[model samples]
Target: MLDIKFIMENSEIVKAACKNKNEQDNVDKIIDLNRMRKIYTAERDELRRQLNEISAEIGEIAKKGGDISSIKVKAKEISEQVKSVEEELSIVEKELDRLVLTVPNIPDSSVPVGFSEDDNKTIRIIGEPQKFDFVPKNHIQLNEKLHLFELERAAKITGSFFPLFTGKGAKLVRSLVNFMLDIHTADGKYYEIFPPFLVNRDSMLGTAQLPKLEEDMYRVEQEDYFLIPTGEVPMTNLYRGEKLSEDDLPIYYCGYSACFRREAGSYGKDTKGLMRLHQFDKVELVKIVHPDNSYDELEGLLHDAEKILDLLGIHYRVRVLCTGDLTFASAKTYDIEIWAPGTEKWLEVSSVSNLTDFQARRMNTRFRSSKDNKLHYVHTLNGSGVAIPRLIISLLETYQNSDGAIEIPEILQDYFGAEKIE
Candidate 1:
């Protein structure tokens, strides 16, 4: 949440951010509501002050053995005025709160100003797409021979875009999850969290997924719970409504969860095989850090995500998302797209973002500084230490042999308990 004070002071910046992010501009309305809120609050305060003075006068008259009924009536009138003003203040504040959540985070100056993903700036490309002597087959084509997954059956069981892995395919998914968790948690770099797949409304709002992306989320009917769209929702809200010590400036957590997205607004997009799915698995990385070092931490977060692809021997490139392409909660983001030769397209496998205290404000997560003994909002960052589906796609397609076999990367061999899937 952008601070209302900051928004009031820097309205233009917030307006530009809303425009850049393709969010509705509610800044003017919020400001108007805030002004009314101030007026109502001041009126209430003044009424209360008058009531207090009238009560004091009534007490003095009563002590002096004089008529106190007039003073009492005046006090009662002022008290009623206070209540009326309080009700007005409550209405204005509620509307202001609602509108505030609609505002998008201000994009960092470094972010490229563009209207689409095509304008995203590529930071670097690592490795090269594997060259095959034979015509490469996509995951679905390779699956027919390897018997990895059953998409039609998954659709029969659930609806379309749900994945059902069988035999080696299931093992591949498990192996990738374990491989990612191990890498991230190794050397105690990130604390592992096994959070619930279902979360309450506040948890969604705390992660800035509510009030905007609710349509793209799966909610439990007749309840306030919603299936998590990503582990970031549960993991990032770990410190919700809490304060930490400055000594714990940087806290790392990694968790694996089944992410569900309704994809309500995603139409005319590729939903073939694992290109997009209603359900997918991911190992999420979250960081709570001091505001001063958030951008640096963002770079480190990107590196940590990149390291997974490096270990897997996959060719991927990192693209810094432009202002218009950034998510509602992210000030800046870097997407890592792995090369899938079979599909002849680059598939985005991970997005590392620096929320820059935007989520911290919404979560009410703060840290007490040892130097000044004051609390300040901590910067929050989250990344797909990598999502599983597309990674599996790249692995299946890139490592395919002439005989329709998959050669697992050396790092993941032990986890898979086999070197190749035939």
Candidate 2:
């Protein structure tokens, strides 16, 4: 949520930023609402003061055993007026809040100017796509040959887009979860946690997953919980409604959770197998840091995610998300896309974003500086240390040997309990 005071003071600047993001529809409305609310607040406050004075006069009249009927009549009229103003004020505030919620976060100055993903500027490519001697099979096909995923049975049990990992596939899923968490814990100095897979509405809103994108989420009909779309929702809300001292400037944690998504309208796109599924596992990295160091820390978090692809020797590149392509809460985002030899395209395995206090403002997570007692919103950042299904897809495609085996990345062999999957 935006600070209404800031918006009131700098409506012009806010409008320009919103216009640049192609969000002009709500700008003028919000600006006007803010103005009206300002005027109404002044009127209401003045009336409240007058009512208090009348109450004091009435008390004095009673104490002196004098006629208080006139003062009582005036007080009754003022009280009725107050009720009317309060009614209008409530409506104005409601509309104002709705408009504010529609406004996207201001883009970082360093972010490149452009509207679409096509306008996104590339950073650099990490490695070359591998070449295969045989007509390479995609992860889905390989899984079929190796008895890894049982799609037919899964379809019968659950609807389409649900696949059951069995034998080698189940092991691969387990290995990826552990492998990603281990790397984040050791290199990133992050605490590891396993958060609940279900979260309340307020928790979802804190992570920017509610109020706007409700259709994309799965909510439990009878409970205060919605199946968490990602681990970030629960992890970021850990410090919700809490205050931290200056000594707790930077807080980092990596969490693993099974994610659920409705995928309401997605069809004819990545529905073949593990590429697009109803349920998947992910290791998420979330950070709460001081405003001054958030960008630097966000970059570090991005690279920490990249290290998994780095250690696996997978080819990938980072792309800065444009305003149109950015998430609602992110001030800036860098998506790390790994090369999938099977599909001959880059599939995003991670997206690191710096929310720059937008999320903290909503969650009430703040830090106090030693210099002054004033509290300020701490910056929030989150990224997929790496998503499992896509990495699994890339791994099966990139590391497959001619003999129809997968050469385990050296770093993961110890965890896999074997050098290769044959």
Candidate 3:
């Protein structure tokens, strides 16, 4: 949510952002509604003042043995007018709030002006994509040969886009989770949090996933809960509606959770394998930092996530998302795409974004600045400290041998309890 004062003061910039982001918001309508609400607010305040004056007059007249009925009637009329104005004010405020929610955060000045992913600029490539001696097989073929997962049975049980990992596959997923969490929590930089997989409507809204992307969520209608689309949702909401001290200005959290999404519009894209799944495991990294230092924290967050790919020896590239490709709440974003040899494509495994108080305002999470002791919204950032499925695909495809065995990354050897999967 943006400060209405900021919107009114910089309407043009806000409108330009709406255009760049490809979001439709009636800036004029929002301004008009706010004007109406302000008018009603003044009228209500004036009515209250008149009523107070009338009450004082009525008391004075009664004490002085003068007839107060006329004054009482005047007060009653003022009271009725106040009630009417209050009702009008309520309606206008509600409408203004709805419109305000539609306004997206302004993209950072550094963000490229573009309308699609094609416009995004690649920052750098990490390691080179593996050159396989064999005609490397895709994850689907590798899984089939290794008896890793049962997608067919998963489809029967859950209707598709679900995987039932068998034996070593299950262990690999668990090992990845532990390994990632261990690194993020190392040196106590990130506190590992165990969050609920189900979140309420407010939690979704706080993370800017509701009102726009609600259709892509699985809702438990009876409980009015939405299955989390990412660990970011719960991790960021941990301090919702709370204020922290300056000492806690930069809080880093990493959470491992199962994420669910409907993939509503992606009907025929990446339907096979773990590329598009209804449920997937993700290790998420979230940071809450003082606004002045938030951008710096974002780079640190990105490095933390990139460390995972580098350590895993996966070939990946980082791209700074163009304005139109940026997430709804993110002011700026960097997408990390890992190369999958068999798929011959770069799969985005994580997005590090600097929301920059966009989410903090929505969540009402703030911190008191030591400099002034004034409360200010904290800047929130989140990245996938890499999502599991695609990373697994990249790993298997990149590490697969001609003999149909998969060599495990050295870092994960201890967790996997083996050097390779045959």
Cα RMSD to the true fold for all candidates: 1.9, 2.2, 1.9
Across 1-422, the per-residue lDDT of candidate 2 in tens digits comes to 67877777777767766766766557777778888898889989999999999999999989999998877888999999998998898899999987787777788988876777787778988999998889777886776567778878988999777768888789888988898888888865999999999999999988778787899888987886899988999999999999999798798999899889888788787766788888888999999999999999989999899998999999999999877777777889999999888777788888899999888988999988877888999999999989988898899889988766888888888877778777
lDDT of each: 0.94, 0.86, 0.92
Candidate 3 structure, TM-score to reference: 0.96
Ranked by lDDT, top first: 1, 3, 2
Clashing pairs in 1: none
Q: Residue-pair clashes per candidate, as listed?
A: 0, 0, 0
- lDDT string for model 3 (1-422, tens) is 88888899999999999999999967899899989988999989998998998898888889999987777877999999999999999998998998888889999999999999999999999888798767889999988789888899999998899888989999999999999999999999999999999999999999999888999999999999999999999999999999999898688999999999999999899887989899999999999898998888989999999999989999999999999998778899999999999989999999999999888999999888888889999999999999999999999999999988999999999999999999
Choose the strongest candidate by lDDT: 1
Residue 380 displacement in candidate 3 (angstroms): 0.5
**Candidate 3: worst 10 consecutive residues by lDDT?**
127-136
TM-score of each: 0.96, 0.93, 0.96
Cα lDDT, model 1, residue 231: 95
- Pitting candidate 2 against candidate 3, the one with the higher TM-score is 3
